[model samples]
Target: MESTAIGLWGIPLAILAGAIRVSTPFIFVSLGETITERSGRINLGLEGTLVFGAMTAYAIAVVTGSPWLGVAGAMAAGASFGLIHGFICRWPKVNDIAIGIAMMQFGLGLAFFLGKPYIQPAAPHLPSIPFGFWSGLPQIQAALDINVLFLIGAALTFALRWVLANTRIGLTLRVVGDSTDAARAMGIDPHRVRLVATAVGGAFAAVGGAYLSLYYPGAWNEGISSGQGLMAVALVIFARWNPVGCFLAALLFGGAGALGPALQSVGVTSGYYLFYAAPYALTLVIMIATSSPNRPVPGMPGALSLTK
Candidate 1:
């Protein structure tokens, strides 16, 4: 059966599908930010990183004819961006947040300049799992075609939560986040830890970009990201820095983001573009509801400047 067989009732299914598709990038980027923030650093440049990653992945996939290789290239590019940010941030007087904004612009400019040629080239797409085998309806089966990276993102969520709770590396990150002096006393180099964490964060964010280009909406262009990287920063805050919470929050945001497209898909065309505001509105509400001068969110890292 074909996916077009569904009637008006397919709206929900379409939303579900869109949520899964849209949420994958959010899941990965938020997870990366969670890790970076937990280590007492923030990388707002991820918006740029995400865009550049999409370009790198698409270009590589086109040249190599392998989507997986494209993903690898994107990760590498992302890590390099992180490295630059980390190194620049090591100066005593440097402001990490400001640097992040600068990096974001730099990355966007570089990506646009380099990606112009690749925009017209075709690239291979990542594979997916046919999760609709049990469903008799074409819409159901089609909606359930799960991408491989989504599974990995889900796993990373739980795994990150567990690692932060139980592992030695997790302890080091927490100590660094709480206080650099404490980390130094424990013989952990805070700078090295943060650099490594930021790099890993960048790599993860890049994978999110790869998923964007090599999977859903599968192509390379300047606007492929739609501010997903920036939104993921808010997502990390909404999750209270919890990896598992990040995953669930990503789904919520994803669902909200999908509302417009879902409605349009079902022939409900009223205020179509307004639906994209769902995510931004939700983020603002979450931030406002959770924030107060007397009591801040519980899980914020001590060294984070944005919340502090």
Candidate 2:
């Protein structure tokens, strides 16, 4: 009876653990999206970039027997993709959203074409910290074995929040996002600012892909990413464009994601497929709750297209 009671209590703990593990990618992707959207651009192609990054990271790690190299390669690929988006969007009357979709398809196609051989190959895994070493419980130890990316994602969130609120570069980013004309008037090149921001955002998104391939699932496969990349765009909107909010919202999404597995573990299996929609449902709810006909949220960039 006592063990049964303990098991019931463990359900929530397991969910929390799953949330922590699963939320890392969401944290990175959402934060990256926040940065890009804040700079008055949106990159829907991050989905493709993510898939390509995952494949590249896995292929590199397999060849070199070094997971760190995989991360570096992923960042390079992401940055290159971002550069392409930035350069192309600079053209007169270019539709950034359309370009984003095209980029996404291009990325996915490229990843599938290049990653064909790596599908079955084994690769090195990313390092993890053993925070549960002192807990003396198997569940605790498993929970504590956190990937380093989680910490990095958390730190980046706080750092980004501070930079946007306190830094001169952040001020300029805001100006460009709000109004390109205003940016030109202030002698701050909106195009240049947006280009840099998009590239950085791509790099971050690539890291999220790296985490998926080399750490969480840790493999090279065509299905490595479902819709995490696309869902992140909605997450940025749901977070109201705040990096810190993005973090917390990611955790919530993660928890929603873990619901199905958690429920199945203890014999609750009524609506398995429905559980998969938890994150999307939350996203829709939040969007409805916060959206307005006029005036964006407090932290949202003025030039962002999502709000309009």
Candidate 3:
């Protein structure tokens, strides 16, 4: 390992920077999962949607030479996947988890097959705001270079929280989440609500995927998502279905994810690769700490199958 000007100090700074850079995808995916779970439904198939979205985004960007259009295409593709999942799960005695798994397989297969062609093409990258311009240090500048999607995700966190707490739509969603019977009594359509919520959640997850390809990793490949879609489901639970909590949890996970690379940057490579498992370990620890056989997770929707 070679010493640089930054030396040992780079580890923490790199982790901090990586947190901001990496957390964007987590924020979007967890928020999306939170929204879906809040509506009394779970979409484990988001992994599929995420990969497919990345593929669609990259393909669109390559063809149209417009990153924004690629984003739209990804959203549409993700929503379509959600629509299929929702429609199938709506049938009597059908299992949502099983259907989700199948959908995930289908999506992965589809993305891999189609994404192969676009793997060699370079897509236009999404724009970023140089938040570090005020600082003279190149490290500071790189760390603070915030993406536009990150800003949107941050604003969306507050907006989603407010919408879930203070709006009529939020009330109806809560009613549906609490009980389908209650929703029916109140003239609300729980199935429709869940369908729309799942679609919206998928769209959000797709945006996260778009961010993965069009921004951070900025590439299209079968493994681009790196299980983020699946992890977001657990993240939603960790956040207790709260959007703000999702944001915080995402940053924590992002920091954990960045730990290895940060350590490596500081010449701490002896066991640096182990840090790559930090996020998964954190997830396991959180699950063990928070979960109990005697009681349900706090803030979990009453109608959620896991609660039963």
TM-score of each: 0.96, 0.95, 0.97
lDDT of 1 by residue, 94-135 (tens): 989999999999999999999999999889899999999998
Q: After superposition, how far is residue 194 of candidate 2 from its true place, in Å?
A: 0.9
Counting only residues 3 or more apart in sequence or on different chains, how many pairs clash (N, Cα, C under 3 Å) in candidate 2?
0
Candidate 2, 1-308: lDDT as tens digits: 12244587667866888898888889988888888888899999899989988988999999999999999999999989998999899999988999999999999999999999999888989999998899866766776788898999999999999999999988888889888899999999888888888988888899989999998888878888878898899889888888998999899988888888777777778998898788778788888787778777666777887633
Between candidates 1 and 3, name the one with more favorable TM-score.
3
In model 3, the runs with Cα more than 4 Å from the true position are 1-3
**How high is the CA lDDT of each candidate model?**
0.91, 0.87, 0.89
Return the top candidate by TM-score.
3
Residue 62 local lDDT, model 3: 97
Clashes per candidate (backbone, < 3 Å)? 0, 0, 0
**Cα RMSD to native, each candidate?**
1.6, 2.0, 1.4
Ordering by lDDT: 1, 3, 2
Error of 1 at 195 (Å): 0.5
Cα shift from native, residue 166, model 2 (Å):
1.7
Model 3, TM vs. native: 0.97
Model 2 segments beyond 4 Å from truth?
1-5
